[model samples]
Target: MHGPDSLVFKSDRPWPNARLRVGAIVGHATSDSVRLWLRTGGPGRFTLLLYDCGEAMGSSSVRAELRAALGRVPVSAEEAAEALAASRTVPFEVDGYADDTTRVLDLADLRPDTRYGYALHSEDDGGKVILGHNRLRSFRTPPGEDERRPFQVALFSCHMPYRVSGLFRKRTDVGDIDAWDFLAATLDRHRDDLDVVIAGGDQCYSDGVGTLDIWKLLNRSMRREGGELLPDERSMRSWYRDIYRGYWGFEGVRRVFDAYPTYMIWDDHEIGDGWGSHYLADDGPDDGLARVLPDLADRGLTRDDGRRLLRRMFRAACAVYREYQHSHNPPTDAGADPDADADADAERDATGADTDAQDVWDYSFTRGGAAFYVLDGRGHRDIERDGYRILGEPQFRRFEAWADALDPEETPFMFVVSAVPVLHARSALANADLAAPVRAAGIGDDLRDSWEHDLHDEERAALMEVLFRAARRGLRPLIVSGDVHCSAVFSLTDDDGHRVWQLTSSAVTYHVPRALGWALRFGAADDGETPEGYAFRRLALYTGTSYALIEVNPAAREAWFKLYGKQIVEEPGPDRGRRAVPLSHSVAKIRLS
Candidate 1:
């Protein structure tokens, strides 16, 4: 709000009157809570709102029954870890200086393998409930690894700002329009065939698309085809919420997350464009990815500022995500020490499942009879070896432990990693996209190095060394990723001498560039590689936006990638018409065989 005396006031006091929006997320679960999160655009006295199904899990409208089940919880991202550790629930205070706010509501003492329904609300100054209320929502905890039930997941990444309109927006159908639901449909159709979906980051973009304001009018006009646009942080929040709501508010997506299960690892967009913990030399501690946006900006997860917030929020997100699934959900009341599960961790290691002796802690999940270890590629790095680093020493230690725990055939492990494409085969190495002055300028310094620089032979080989571990051990490896915009595939050689596989699906809604896309399709019109330096050794020629549907058999040591064929899938035959032309459905049995 602007006034003579009052400088700039960013508050949720006025809902539609301002840009503060609400973002809700449900991913990777834990015992007590469902990993519930939301953004508050800016700062003020924010209330932790939860809708009471009042009952248990089921087909129930939970709005009316959800009374003032509100907690006077007050908290912020700046609070000391000690404070966060000690408090049960604190009132959330919105920081309106910038255009963001995010908080994780840890609903402890929940039941395992049960579904809990919920919704969000915001009340500034502890005055009145001004934000979302009674909007039906829910999540399920995971069934323990030994629960005897099979596992499944919904692996996704690069979920973006506008699928409704353009420059940055995509031309997607309702099936694709509601991308999350589309993913849910995929999970639904193949519910029995999968365990969980692993999201490999770039889940949302902030520095992308000028601002959220322009995105709003642009979306409203998708149907209207025209509208007066005013893009800014405030507009961005609502636009962002609308975009996220498209995913979470869907029946299919919500049901799957609530029934099946999922795990997410952050990339640049989760916080903002080109964000890194300390990747940038000049960025302030609260720089690009570190700068806080409203929970609305991040759709209620981690903002685009940096990894610190995500690290803070990861434990929280895991809670809700696990609670929604029958698997992974821990008992909230007390005594169900996740430590109890940790108790057998050593035994798993002894069984020759977890194989490393490195002193580091990392996370791994079990589903579909497979173990997915998310090795962080962005923040934690020891980039001192020949100018490039492997999964760093600490993370590498964690990997060794994870590998030792895998029995090759028992629970065949698929490393659902963010950056495990351990090869660099670029045939085309020339050309530049002066694309449009605007785009060339937009991508500017922010993306040039990323898009322009291809991995040198040295770095590629080093990555392969680390990658060889998974292969040498007779494990079929699968890589899920987002940072790059188009869907592509890579091949890896296992230790047992079998050729493993790596699959990459680009931005769910983001694009590299029309010029880059063209270069990606064919070679550079002028040079063989194009203006950007990337080259594809086995770059399968395909087009349109896409994601991946991965299938793995830990026992068989077999894995395959299913590209969204209807959109980009290319293999066509009579049966193909019956099925769909999968863009990159290359399949190969994996083993150290």
Candidate 2:
């Protein structure tokens, strides 16, 4: 139980590995907390034969137990399954997945603004030991205090670590920039202007990659001419370790998280081929399949066992984060000067300071007069636009209910967040048709799902209807996202005369391939993204090699999006002398008059 390399959950029956986690990875501040999501790696069979035996909620001593030998009690497998099923502390929701590898533990009635401590547990590692141990981890929760605090926010997203193979772009056209390299640069110049950063998604890759696994058949398909193919699971697993280790393992990005409070989520690359919601089957895993094909989505691969591994990684990390936060509280300064530490001053006015003046370490807090709703888009989303359902019925219901429950009568601004930008780029893409065919192709996302595809028009019609209605009701809607790999702004007019603004920032390091994107010159490409750029008028303003300096004045109902150092694509303006420029996109703030 005390060793690092323990036989996590070794068991007699091994198909259904023993351990699955029930926790979340959260980013926090003193005022509120944001839940990345809570998940459990599932498949109920004879997985890891381990159990979570943490000390009581607030204690250091935990009860460790070895349960794998229970078979000697003469209990039948079904009996044991019943007992285990009855012991869970949280509710479970899962679709049949051959890759029945995960069960998530999401938030239910999470407080609006507050700070919390959180963490997770692991069943396996390197070597031998007991089957049970402590559940405590190093992690902090989203800020939960909504006393109307004042804080700065750093925004960004879209970090695709893989360099595009010639299939999508020319290697000579542009080389890849690691995600951390860009973040370090951004922080170098603008660390003083912000509080925390939020990512839209693509945090990890799911599809087989060349750098990680040149062994899988999937990798063969991914390569330009298709050469080496991974012959087995061991090779595939090796790929998983390589690709993931390459990015998350980056020391620079980890520093950013440690330097500033950060919130993250997953999008397409976290899985594979954008719409895996269409998994073809849910039966137990076979040597041939890694993900489960959803019986519902016409047999699309939705539940890859590989995804569960990634999810487990996310949950475990979050747990470690919670453990860290509780153990190491960041220093706070409340002096009139940002440079001074006012211990006496802070103690005296701790409860009296305006919410707006406090630092945002975890969750959404009331700043100025707006309610910033930052949440997970990929975790809760039901395949988008193809009629697959944007938000699942449950999530959608909750969203509307939350909106209805909002006391708009008392609020002025509503800044909503998704790791991915929510604004529809159809108009911009539509404009691309006027450009070269290759560029026009850029307008169409081959991955558009039921949520954004066949039912896109209807979904848009409905979303506008609700959002506009909310605006008329005095709810200013501002949607922010990050997965697009670019930064920009967008606006929409709702039927109710309400205005919608969207702001997007992508990987402080990752960038789009330059060649496949060459259609830019042929069309109205700004930085080679095409008509979408035309629609948003997105200028790369600053290469993310420099982090973004994002500021939001909740009281004033304004948002400032800027890059910290390098200036590449920017709105037409004078040399402001600052490394960061106010991006025109709504990726960060929502202010309604």
| Top-scoring candidate (TM-score) | 1
lDDT of 1 by residue, 29-135 (tens): 65444555555555666545333323442334333333222222442222211221223334666554332255555566766565554433345443433333323
Model 2: lDDT of residue 588: 34
Clashes of each: 104, 117
- Runs in model 2 deviating more than 4 A are 1-26, 32-149, 162-195, 207-209, 213-242, 277-370, 374-388, 409-411, 432-452, 495-497, 511-549, 563-565, 568-593
Clashes of 2: 117
Give model 1's clash tally.
104
Candidate 2 structure quality by residue, lDDT tens digits, 1-593 = 11111122323211111122332233434333332333334322222221222234234322122233222244443333343332222323343321213222333343333222232222223222111112222223333334333445666555454444566532322234443655655553444334456655565554424333222323232211122211222222323333333445444554455344555544545544443333233342221123322221232223433333233223222222222221122222211221212232233233333221232222343443456555433433343224415444444454555566556645556666655455433323345464465454543333243223444445445544555667777777766675544455556553334566666665555444432123322232232221212123333322243344445555455555554433335445676344443233322333323
Q: Which ten residues in a row have the lowest lDDT in candidate 1?
A: 331-340
C-alpha lDDT score of every prediction, in listed order: 0.42, 0.39
Give TM-scores for every candidate, taking all chains together and pairing residue i with residue i. 0.54, 0.51
